[model samples]
Target: MLKAKAIRIREPGGPEVLELGEVELSAPGPSQVLVEVAAAGLNRADCLQRRGFYPAPPGVPADVPGLEFAGLVESVGNEVSDWKPGDRVMGIVGGGSMTTRLVTEGAELMSVPAQLSLEEAAAVPEAFLTAYDAVVLQGGLRAGQTVLLHAVASGVGTAGIQIATAVGASSVGTSRSAHKLPRCTGLGLTHAVLVEDGRFADNVLAAVPNGADVILDTIGAAYLSQNIKVIAKQGRLIVIGLMGGVKAELALGALLAKRASIHGSVLRSRSSKEKAELTKSFIDQMLGKLESGELKPIVDEVMEMADVRSAHERMDSNETFGKLVLRW
Candidate 1:
């Protein structure tokens, strides 16, 4: 058995519940690899899990709350041949990534881009992967199309802007704060809407005229109706978070008239096989852009593993623009 320091939650309630302590880990199983974690990215889901709202998926360590990590390979199981000790990797997991070391299936890992630091790499897997899947694959965003993204300065929103730019699409983004809009312009945001009292649809429509071909929403119920109003014919609306409340009354008539589609996505609950497939797709599509600096991780802050509580507090306060990385 190997011993490592990890942030474990004694009982889910608040950021104060997170505790740093020693934990035991067994050797990797066949097809798995052991990684010496260098950094882990903080997500809104981590805050939700810490508050007892979102539980880790079955088979994940419920007490350990983290979704993405970047690290060096320490060991590999007998069945793993593609990766060996010393390989640099970054990837997403269901949980248990808030530790000094972790075991994950070799197929689930992505080789860290040569240009990125481990802290930068830690911010990529979750944000980029989620944005790519929603905007490109599911939303069927094509070149010259228009996309509107909520929470404009967020990790995923910044990623979407870059991805859309790389593919020759235009993006309009909305944020509650007017200050964040300026920062997003550097990421290729074509339009920035400052949402006041939940009014953004008019600005989005004004920017695009024909309406957005895709809407990537992090705020749920609060933005649903407005999203519907601003989406183009046959547009795809992908909801990946519920920063707002969950339940909302929908305008089915408008939805049908526009022939729009809405999808809800959560990466953590996906099966290992599904995650591996997405990771492979991401590598094929976005790795080159990442290497060439066309795409980059937008990190808001970095903290030590011992400062996990403060990290959570920052995210909870909604003051962060991009990812908050925790270095081990």
Candidate 2:
């Protein structure tokens, strides 16, 4: 048995409940790869999981928690020829990432771009893949169009801005921070609106003047009604988070008048085949941006594996502008 250190919930409530301990890890299965985790990213989903609002997908151990990581391949299982020992990779999984070593789906792993550090690479998959699926796959963001992204300083938010730019689409990003607003602006976002200062609709519409061709939002029900007002004809609104609340009243007239569509996505709920497809698309379409330095992972805070509790605190308090990673 290999002893691996991990953070777990001992009855969830808050970050303080994240207990660190050593556990015995088993060897990889035929379709799995054992990775010595170099870094693991913290996400809003992590907080939800810690609060008992989320759990590992079926078949994953209920006690473990985490969704993504960057690491070296310690060993490859049979029939996994695309990777071998010593290879650096990043990938997403059901959970169990809060460990020194863990198992991952062999097919989900992607080669880390040469220019990226392991910790930075750890921050890549969940945010970027999620943003990619929303903006490109479902939202139909196109070149010469415009997009509005809420919580634009988040991991997925920042990723959305870079992706919008890479696809030749102009973007207006929103944040509560006047200070952190510049980071999104630095990514070539067409507009940076301070959400705390006022409503985002004005800034977003002012940038495009008509309305946003696409709205990539994580605010959920809080912005549901307002989103309907800002979306252009046949526009797309993709909601990926529900930080404010889960239910809202919608104006059916607005929907009929604009002919717009709303899409809600959760990456963890996807099937293995679906995940594989998304991973392939992201690698094929997004890797070049990383290689060209047009897209980069945003890492806000990094902590030692033992300090998982503190990492959770920073994320929960909204103290971070980008991804917070835990290094093993």
Candidate 3:
């Protein structure tokens, strides 16, 4: 086992409970690699974990909180032949990413784009992968189709906009902050809707009367009705987060009439094989774009991991336009 410094959640509560401490990391298994973590990205899920609303899955460190990291490969197990020491890689984990070192399956790692720093790379995996999986893969978004993206200024939101544009699909993004919409539009958003009172169907309809072919929603229950109202025929509503609330009455009649479908997706709880497959698919389809600057990681700010409390506070307050990345 290797002794490593990590961010430990002392108890379920606010950011105050988070503390930088030491933990033990087992040596890489036959198919694993040990990474010297340079940085990690903060996600809303991390906040939920800190509050005790979300717990790490079995086999993950229960007290550590982080979903993604970018770093250098320190060592690889004997059975790992693809990566060598010092390779720059980034990927998602179930937990324990906010640490000085991480041990993850070698197949789950993607090469960091040469143009991006590790800090910037830290912001990519969770956001881009989630958006790609929901908006493109599962949603089956095609060229000339339309996608509705909520929380346009968020990490996944920004990524969705770019991915939609890259695929020749139109994107209508919604945001609570008017100021953030302009930046989202600059990121290739076709239409911007300012959500009010948990409403956006009217504005989305005005922009695309046929309704959106794909709806990537982060806000749960609160947007269910509006989502149903604005879905096009055979539309796909991909729900990746439940920030608003968990329970809501579903408009089954309306959904049935449109012949649409809803999918609930989460990356953290997926099996290692599933994650590896997703990583491989993403690399094959999107890595070139990342390397060529066609797809970029939108980072709101980079801060020292020691100030993780402030990072969580800012995220909870919805003060960031994109990702909040932390480095050791």
Candidate 4:
């Protein structure tokens, strides 16, 4: 067994409840790899987990809250042949990623692009995978199409903007912070809409006229009706987070008239096999862009792991323009 230092949630409450602690890890089983984590990305989901709203999936440490990590492979299980000690890797996990060491399936790992540092790589897996899976794979975004992304300065939103641009599609992004919109525009966002009082459908229409071919939404129920109003005929709306609210009346008439579809996605709750498939798809489709600098993780800041509480507070307050990476 190996001992690892990690951030633990003392209880269901605020950032003050977080503390540093130690956990034990067994040797990697066959097909698994042990990693020395360099850094981990801080997501809003981590904040939710700390507040007792999101629980880690079964088999993961319920008290440890992290969803993505970047690290150096320390050892590979006997049956694992694709990686060796010292290889730089990054990927998503169900939880328990904010630690000095972790064990996971080798198949889940992606090589850290030579163009990116480990801290930058820590911000890649979760945001890029979520955006690629939601925007390209499920949304079926095509060349000449337009995608409307809510929370446009978020990690996923920034990644979505670049993905849309890389695929020859245009992107219109929304944000309550006008200061952040210019960064999104510099990242290839074709249009920026400053949403005021949750009213953006008219502005979205004004930008695209015909409406968006795809809408990647993180603010769930609160934006449902407006999403329906802004969707183009046969548009696909992919909902990946419920930051706004969970319960709202759906406008069935508007949905039916537009012939649109809505998909709710969560990466952490997925089965290992399903996540591996998604990782493979992302690597095949998007990894080269990351390697070539065509697409990059837009990291808002990197902080020491000891400052995790502040990181969580920043995310909860919606002050970050992109991802926050925490390193031990």
- Report how far residue 171 has shifted in candidate 4, in Å: 0.3
Model 3 global lDDT (CA atoms, 0 to 1)? 0.96
lDDT of 2 by residue, 76-169 (tens): 8897898999999999887888788988778889999999999999999999999999999999999999889999999999999999989999
Clashing pairs in 4: none
lDDT by residue (1-328, candidate 3, tens digit) is: 7999999999999999999999998999999999999999999999999999999999999999999999999999999999999999999999999999999999999999999999999999999999999998999998999999999899999999999998999999999998999999899999999998878999999999999999999999999999999999999999998998889999899999999999999999999999999999999988899999999999999999999999999999999999999999
Q: What pairs collide in candidate 3?
A: none
Which regions of candidate 1 are displaced past 4 Å?
Answer: none
lDDT of 2 at 40: 90
Tens-digit lDDT track for model 4 on 1-328? 8999999999999999999999999999999999999999999899999999999989999999999999999999999999999999999999999999999999999999997999999999999999999999999999999999999999999999999999999999999999999999999999999999989999999999999999999999999999999999999999999988999999898889989999988899898899889999988989999999999999999999999999989998999998999999
Worst 10 residues of 1 by lDDT: 5-14
Steric collisions counted per model: 0, 0, 0, 0
Cα lDDT of candidate 2 equals 0.87
Model 2: ten consecutive residues of lowest lDDT: 196-205
Q: Is candidate 1 or candidate 2 better by lDDT?
A: 1
Overall lDDT per candidate, in order of appearance: 0.93, 0.87, 0.96, 0.95
Best by lDDT: 3
